[model samples]
Target: MQNLILLLITAGSSSLCACTIQPQAEPVPSRHVSTIVIRQPRGEPGDFIICNDGRVLVFPVAHPKTCS
Candidate 1:
């Protein structure tokens, strides 16, 4: 009987060990709201966006070698 009780306690405590404790995030302050969406093409990885006012954003154009 005592071994059964100890087994139950061990199982309960081990289950509690699986619980996760996540750190809370700090509050962030923001003023302006802006959004940009970049769509991934079917196969290529060099795609980007140059949208105007959150709409009709065209894909990235060929950049000049020294357009820094």
Candidate 2:
């Protein structure tokens, strides 16, 4: 029937439109070097761990001057 053909055409066009419409992701700012002074009396250089947000890190130190 003509109605059945029209229904099929409408359904196909809706599915094609749904496939073309995609959700976009929000952009995140690029990470840059952010420094924090070692407060502890004994800590070493090059000993660092990154935070979850890709910013704010903790650097452990074993000696006052030499950081490794």
Best by TM-score: 2
- TM for every model, in the order presented, reads 0.29, 0.32
Candidate 1, residues 1-68, lDDT tens digits: the string is: 99999999999888777554445677888888899998766743344554445544334355422212
Over 1-68, each residue of candidate 2 has an lDDT whose tens digit, in order, gives: 99999999999999989878977677998798798896755535545555556664454455323222
Instruction: Extract clashing residue pairs from model 2.
Output: 43-61, 43-62, 44-61, 44-62, 44-67, 45-67, 45-68
Deviation in Å, model 1, residue 19 alpha carbon: 1.9
Model 2: worst 10 consecutive residues (lDDT sum): 59-68
Residue 8, model 1, lDDT: 100
**Once model 2 is optimally superposed onto the true structure by TM-score, how far is the C-alpha of residue 42 displaced, in angstroms?**
62
Residue 34 alpha-carbon offset, candidate 2, angstroms? 39
lDDT of each: 0.60, 0.67
Query: What ranges in model 1 sit over 4 Å off?
Result: 21-68
